[model samples]
Target: MSSTATHTDDDLMTVPDVLHVLRPLSKRTFYRWRETGKAPICIRLPNGELRIHRSDFKEWLDSHREQVAA
Candidate 1:
């Protein structure tokens, strides 16, 4: 398979990567929210790995902003 195909098929991202994308929030805060069920829902892959979809995270952020504005 081509490199793009391989990467597209494996679009899962790690917690650190998500943290990098959503900076201003500490890694410890993310982990704490994850543990407390306050973080965005995550997907558990067949290999027992955890990942957060970028689109879902963005949706969560938008909804949260709306809630705060209300």
Candidate 2:
């Protein structure tokens, strides 16, 4: 199989990467979302680091899409 077949698995993102893209203004705010179940599904590794699958993150972002008045 070509690498593209595994692209989905290779695109997992860390919390910092997600925050960088979302730019929600603060880590506290993101943490609050996680705590309140407003954020996307997050995976907690046995070592304690958090992970978010790329597809799940995109779905979460799309689900919360809102237009802001420019």
Best of the candidates, lDDT: 2
What is the per-residue lDDT of model 2 for residues 1-70, given as tens digits with 9 covering 90 to 100? 6665444744779989888998864778888988998988999999999999999988888888898999
- If scored against the real structure, what TM-score would every candidate get? 0.61, 0.75
- Residue by residue across 1-70, what tens digits does model 1's lDDT show? 5565333423666778778878877989998998998887789889977797766676667767744455
Candidate 2 overall Cα lDDT vs. reference?
0.85
For model 2, the superposed segments whose C-alpha errors exceed 4 Å read: 1-10, 67-70
What's model 2's lDDT at 41? Answer: 93
Candidate 1 residue 39 Cα shift, in angstroms, is: 0.7
- Per-candidate clashes come to 0, 0
Per-residue lDDT, model 1, residue 56, is 68
Top-TM-score candidate index: 2
Q: Which residue pairs in candidate 2 collide?
A: none
